[model samples]
Target: MRFATYELDGSVHAGVVSDDGLHTLPSGTTVLDLVRAGLPAALTAGSAALTGPPTPLDLARLLPPLTPPTIRDFVAFEEHVEGVVASVSGGSGVPAEWYEAPTFYFTNPYALIGAHDDVPVPPGSRLLDFELEVAAVVGRDGSSLTPAQASDAIFGYTVFNDWSARDLQRREMKVGLGPAKGKDSATTLGPWLVTADELAPFHDEDGFLALDMRVSVNGVEVGHDLLSNMGWPFAELVSYASRGTWVRAGDVLGSGTCGNGGCLAELWGRRGEQDPPALRPGDVVEMTVEGIGTIRNRVVPGIELPPVRAARSRTRAR
Candidate 1:
C-alpha cells in the first residue's frame, strides 16, 4: 500500500493512500511511527482501524514520507558516473574502485522538502540540476547483515530528487572531500511511499527493481532511465551501508541516479550546453518512477548570504 504524511488543519498525520484519498492511520501519529511499529504490517493493521471520511489528496498538503533519522545516498550506477566524469575537464572514465563496492555519502536530514514544495535556486549555482532516483526506507534496525538479510530490513520505496548545485559541488570536490554545502542545501523525497510488498512484482531476476525513472524540467524531458540499470542492487547497498555500522529504522538509502541520462550533468557531457539548459528560478521539475508516482516542484530564488572568502592558514609562516 502507498503511505504518506500529510497536513490537515496544521497538523501532520500518517495515512494510507486509497482510490478516494488519504485514510488516516489510527495506529500511528506519523509515518515514522508506522515504520517503527513494523512497516507494512503495522500500516495494514492501522489502516484497518481508520474511520471517518478520507481526505482527497488534492485538498491536503503532502509532506515528505517522514523526516528520516539519517540519509545515505549512494553512487550505484556506472554509466551515470562515467558521463558525469567525462563532462569535466581533465576527467576520464569511472574510477576502478567504484566497481568494488557501493559508496555513499551522508546528506543533511534537516534540508528535506516534500513534493510540490518550492526549491530554492541555490545562489551562485548556474549549473543547478536534479537527479532522479529511488530510495528505500529502512524498516528495522540491523548491523553487518548480508545482502539477503538486508533485503528484509527494507520498509518501502519513494521517488528521490537529489537537487544539486553543480558549481559548488565542483569547487568542493576539487578539495578531495565529499559534497557539503553543494548538496546539504536541499533534497526532495515524496509524493508517497510505496511499501515493499506492493513493489515485489517489479523485481527482476537479479533482484533489482525494473522500474522506469524519468525527469522533466518546465515540462521538457531532461532525463529518463530504468532503475534496473544500477550496477549494485538496493539490498547490496543496504548491506554495504551496514558494514561496521548500524542501519536503524527511519534511515533512508537512495539508489543513486539511474543510468540512461538520469541527471543533467550526464546530458551536458552528451549534448553540450544549449539544447536543454540548466535549471533556473521558476522552472518546475517533475520526477516520476513507474510505481512511485510523481513529485513536482517549482524552483524559487535562494536566500542570499555573506560572500565566502578563503580562510587564512595559521600553521604556515606568513
Candidate 2:
C-alpha cells in the first residue's frame, strides 16, 4: 500500500492511498508509527479499522513521508562516481576503496522538505543542482545486520532528491572534510512511501530493483537510468550502514544518484564542461521512479548570510 502524510484543513493526517481516496489511518498515527509496527501488520489490520471518511488525494498537501531520524546517502552507482569524479577532480575512475564496500555520509535530517515544496538556493551558492535517487526507510532497529536481515528491516521506499550546491561543495571538500553546508540546505522526499512488498516484483535475483528512474527540469526531461545498474544494492547499503551501529526505524538510506545524467554535475563531467546551466530560481525539478511515484520541487532565492571568516591558528610552534 502507498502510505502518505498530508495536510488537510490546516491539520496533518496519515493515511493509505487508494483509487477512491486516501483512507485515514487511526487518529494520531503517523507514517513512522506504521513503520515501527511493520507494513505487514498494518496491511493485516487494514483500512477497515479507520475511523473517518477518506480524503481525496488531490485535496491534501503532501509532506515528507516521515521526518527521518538519520539520513545516510550512498554512492552505489559506479557510473555516477566516475562521471562526478571526472567533473570535479579531472579524474576518470572511482577510488578502489569504493569497490570494497558501500560508503555513505550523513546528511542533515532537519533540512528535509516535502515533494512539492519550494527549495531555496543555499546561501552563497551559485551552482545549485539536484540529484535523482531513491531512499529506503528502515522499519526496525538493528546493528551488525547481514544483507538479508537488512532487506527484511526495510519497510518502504520513497523518491529522494538530494539537492546540492556544487560550488560550495567544491570549496569545502578542499579542506578534506565536508560536503556539509553545501548539502545541508534542503532535501526532498515524498509524494508518498511505497511499501517494500509492493516493489517485490521489480527485484532481481541479485537483489537489485530494476525500476526505471527519471528526472526533469521545468518539464523538460534531463536524465534517465535504471536502479538495477548500481554497483551495490540497497540491502548492502543498509547492511554496511548497520555495521557496529544501529539503524533504527525512520532512518533513511539513499540509493545515491543513478547514472546517465542523474544530476547536472554528471552531465558536466561527461561533457568536460566547467560551466553548464545550473538550477536557478523558478526552475522546477521532478524525479520519478517506477512503482515509487514522483516528487516535484521548485527552486527559489535563498536568504544570504554574512560570510564566515577563517579562524586564527592557536597551536603554531607551541
Candidate 3:
C-alpha cells in the first residue's frame, strides 16, 4: 500500500492511494501516524475516511510524507564511497572501518521539503548538487537489533534527494570534522511512501530489494543504478544505526547516494577533474526509484544567512 501526506481543502491528511483516488484517514493523522500504528493492518481496517473522488495526484500538494522524527543517512554503496574518497582524499581506498559497519551522520530534520517544492541554493554555495537516494522510515522503537530483526522495523520506502553544497562541504571536511553547514541546508523526501510488503516481489537472492534508481537534472539523465548493488544492505544499515540508541518510529534512514554516477562529485572524479555542472536557479531535479515514485524539485536562490564561522571564532576566543 502507498501512503502519503497531502494537502486537500487547505488541510494536511494522511491516506492510501487507491485506483479511484486518495483515501484519507482522520483529520490531523499523518503518514508517520500510519507507520507508527503499523501499515497493512492499519490500512486494511478501513478506519481512515476516504476523501471525495480520488484526488488527482497533480492536484494534491505533497509534503515530506511526514517530517521525520529523526534522520540518519548511511553510505552503504561501496562504489559511491570509493568515488567520494578518491575525489576528496586524493587516492585513499575505502576506509577499513566502513567495511566493519555502516557509517552514517544525522542531518537536520527541519530542512525537509516535499515533492515539487522549491530548493533554495544555499548562500555562498556555487557548486550545488543533489545526491540521488532511497530512504526507509522506521515503524517502531528498537535498539541493538541484529540485521534480520532490524529488517522488520522498516515501515516503508521512498525516494530521497540529499541536496548538497559541494564547495561548502569540501571546506569543512578539511578541518577534519565533517559536513555541517555544507549539508544542513535542505533534503527532499517524497512523492509517496511505498509499504515494504509491496516490494516482496522484487527481492533478490540475498533478500535485498532489486529496484532501479535514476536521476535527471533539467530533463537530462545524469545517473542510473540498481539498488541491489549496495555493498551493505538496508537491514545492516538499520541494525548499525540502532546500536546503543533507540530507533524510533518516524526515524528516516537514507541509502545515501547510489553508485553509477549518483552525484556530480563522482562524475567529476571519473572525468579527470573536469568541472562538473552545478545546479542553478530554475533547474529541475527529478529522482525516481522503481518501486517508489518520482520527487521533482526546482532550485531557487536563497539569501545568505549570517556567517557561522565568525560566531564560532568569537566563542573560541572567550
Candidate 4:
C-alpha cells in the first residue's frame, strides 16, 4: 500500500493512497506513527479502519511522507564512485576500502523538503547538482542486525534527491571533513511511500530491488539506471548502518547516486566537458523510481551571507 502525508483544507493529514482517493487516517496520526506501529499492524489497520470519506487525491498538496529521525546516505554504487573520483581528482578507481564495506555519511534530516517544493541554490554556490537516488524508511528499531534482518525491518521506499552544491562540496572536502554546508541545504523525499510488500515483484534473488530509475531536468532526460546496479544492496547498507549502532523507526537510508550521469559531475568526468549546464534558478528536476513515484522540484535563488573570516597567524614564544 502507498502512504502519504498531505495538506487539505489548511490541515495536514496522513493517509493511505487508493485508486479512488486518499483514505485519511485518524486525526494527528502521521506516516511516521504508522511506520512505528510496524508494517503488519499498519496493513491490518488499513483504510478500512477510517471513518471519514476519502479525500480527493488531486485536491491535497503532498508533503514529505515523514520527517525522518535521521538520514544516512550511502555511496553504494561502484560506477558512481569511479566517475566522481575521476571528476574531482582525475582518479580512475574506487577507493580500496570502499570495496570492504558499504560507506555512508549523515545528512541533516531537518533540511528535507516535499517532492514538489522549490529548492534554493545554496548561498555562494554557482554549480548546483541533483543526485537521483532511492531511500528506504526503517519500520522498526534494530542494532547489530544481519543483512536479512535489516531487509525485514524496512517499512517502505521513496524517491530521494540529494541536492548538492558541487563547488561548496569540493572546497569543504579539501579540509578532509565534509560535504556539510554543501549538502545540508536541501534533500527531497516523496510523492508517497510504497510499502516493502508492494515491491515484492521487483526483488531479485539476492533481495536487491531491480527497479528502473531515471532523472530528468526541465523536460530532457539526463540519467538512467537500475537500482540493482549498486555495489551493495539496500539490505547491506542498512545492516552496515546498524553496525554497533542503531537504526530506528523513521530513520531513512538512501541508495546514494546512481551511475551513468546520475549527477553532472559524473557526466562531466565521462565526457571531459562541463556541458549540459549546471542547475540554475527556475530549472526543474524530476526523479522517478519504478514502483515508488516521481518527485519534481524547481530551483530558486538563495539568501547569501558574508564569507567567514580567515584565521589569524599564531605568534611563536621565545
Candidate 5:
C-alpha cells in the first residue's frame, strides 16, 4: 500500500493510494493506524472511502507527508562521495570517520516540493544539480535499534531529489557545519510513500528487484544507475541513524545519491566557471528510479529575492 499527504479544498490530508483511487485517511494521521489495525482493517477503511466518488487528485500531488518534522538525510553511498570528491577542486573527502556511521543533515521543512511541483532556481545557485536517492519513511518510533531490528521499523519508500546549490554548499560545508544553503534551500521528495512490503523485493539481491534509475534534462539522458548499486543497505542505515536519535513515524531518511553518474557533478566530471550545468528557465529535469515511478520538474528563474541579510545569515549557519 502507498500513502500520500495531499491538498484538497485548501487543507492537507493523508490518504492511501489504491488502484481504485486514493482513499482518504485522517488528517495528521499515519499508516501506523492502518498497520496496527492490521492490513485488513486498513484496506477495508481505505477501500470503503472509494465508494463516494472521491475527489480525483493528481497522484503526483504534494502535501507535507509529516505536517512538519525533523528530516534527516543520510550520506550512505561511497560511490557518490568518491564522485563528488573527484569532481571538486580538491575532491570531497574528510577523515575516515565521515563514513563510520550513517551521516545526515537537517533540511528546512518548508523547502519540500511535492512530486509534481516546480523547483524554483535558487538564488545565486548557478550550479544547481539533482541527486537521485530513495528515502525511508519511518513507521515505528525508536531511539536506537540494531540493523536487523531497524528493518522492521520502516513504513515505506519514496524517490527523493536532494537538490544542491554547489557553489554555496562548497563554501559552507568546508567550515564543518552540516550542509546549509547548499542543501537547505530546496529538497524535492515524494510522488507517494510506498509501504515497506511493496518495497521489500528491492532488499533481497536473490530476488534483486530491478530498480533502474535515470535522470534527464531537456529530454537528454545525463545520469543513470541501478538501485542495486547502493553501498550500504537501508536496514543498516536506519539502525545507525536511530541509534543516537529519535526517529518517529513519518520522519524521512534518505539513501544519499546512488552511483554511476548520479549527479551532474559526477556526470560531467570536474566543472569550471566556463562549463556549469546550472538549471535555467524553461529547462526541464526528470528522474525515475525503477520501481519508484518518475518525478519531472521544470526550472524557472526566481523573480523576487529574499532579504539579502537574512539569506546570507541562514546560509552561514547551514
Candidate 6:
C-alpha cells in the first residue's frame, strides 16, 4: 500500500492512496501511528487502503513519506563506495577491506521536505547536488537483529533526495564528524511509502519491477540509473545495518547515494577539481524512481550562510 501525509485547508492528514482517491488515515494518525499499532496489522490495513481511498492523489500534493523518529543513512552501495574511494585516492579499485560492513550517519529527521517543495539554496554552497536513493522505514523496534530477521522489521520504502552541498561536505568530513553540516541542511522525501509486501516482488532480478531513476535541472536530464543495478541489495543493507544496533519503527534508513555519477559530484566531475556545474536560482531538480514515483524541488538561491564552520564548532564546544 502507498501511504502519505498531506495538508488540505491548512491541516495535515494521513491516508492511503487508491485508484479512487486518497482515503484520509485520521486527523491525529500518521504512518508512524500505524507502526505503533502493530506492523503486521498495519501492513494488512495499508494494503487494503491502497486502491480504496475515496480521495484523489491529484487533490493532494505529496508529503515526505513519514515523519520519522530518526533518520540514518548507510553506505551500502559498493559501486558508489568504489567510485568515491577511487576518486578520492586516485585509485582504480576499492580495497577489499572497505566492503566488510556498512557505514552510516544520522540526519535530522525534522529537516525533511516533501515532494514538490522548493529546496532552499543554502548560503555558501556554490555546488549543490542530488543523490537518488531508496530509504527503508523501520518497523518492529529491536536491537542486534540478525540479517534473517531484518526483513520483517522493515516497514516500507521511499525515494529519497539526499540534497547536498558538495563543497562543505568535502571540507568538514576532513574533521571526521561529518558529512554533517554539509548534509544537514535539507533532505527531500515523499510522495508516499510503498509497504514491503507491495514491493516484495521487486526483489527479483530482471527487475521486472524496475524503478527507473531520473534527475533533471530546469527540465534537463542530468543523472539517471536503475534500481536493479545497485551493487548492494536492500535486504543486505538492512541486515548489515542492524547487526549491532537498535532501529525502531518510523526510523528511515537511507540507501546511501546511488552510483557515483547519479549525484552531482560525479555528474559534473567535482572530484577531478576542474569545474563542476553549480546550480543558480530558479534551477529546479526533479528525481524519479521507478515504482516509487517522482519528487520535484526548485532551487532558489539564498544569501550565503557563511559556510557555517565556526558556528558548528561553537555549537559542538558548548
Best candidate (score: lDDT):
4
Task: Write one digit per residue (lDDT tens) for candidate 2, span 65-168.
Answer: 88788999998999899998887656788999989888889999999899899999998998999999999999999999999999999999999999999888
Tell me the tens digit of each residue's lDDT in model 3 across 154-208.
Answer: 8888898999898898888888887787889999988888888888798888968
lDDT of each: 0.86, 0.89, 0.83, 0.89, 0.70, 0.73
Model 6 per-residue lDDT tens digits across residues 1-318? 778888776778888876677778645778888866666777666666664447666766677867888888876556666665543334555567657666788898877999888888666776777777878887778777765577778878888888888777777766757877678778998778878778876676532235667777778787666666665666666677666777777888888877736676653443565233776678888888777778888887666544344543345554
Q: Model 5, 95-184: lDDT tens per residue?
A: 386567667777776788877778777787777888888887766788888876777777667888888887777777778786788887
Q: After superposition, how far is residue 41 of candidate 5 from its true place, in Å?
A: 6.3
lDDT of 2: 0.89
RMSD of 1: 1.7
- In model 5, which runs have C-alpha deviations exceeding 4 angstroms? 26-44, 50-60, 92-95, 205-210, 270-276, 303-318
Global local distance difference test of model 5: 0.70
Q: Where does candidate 6 stray beyond 4 Å?
A: 47-53, 85-96, 205-210, 270-276, 303-318
In angstroms, the error of model 2 at 316 is 2.2
Error of 4 at 83 (Å): 1.2
- Mind giving the per-residue lDDT tens digits that candidate 1 earns over 102-207? 8899999999899989999787777788899899999999999999999999999999989988888888888889888778878899998899988999999999
TM-score, cand. 5: 0.83
By lDDT: ranked, best first? 4, 2, 1, 3, 6, 5
Clashes of 6: 8
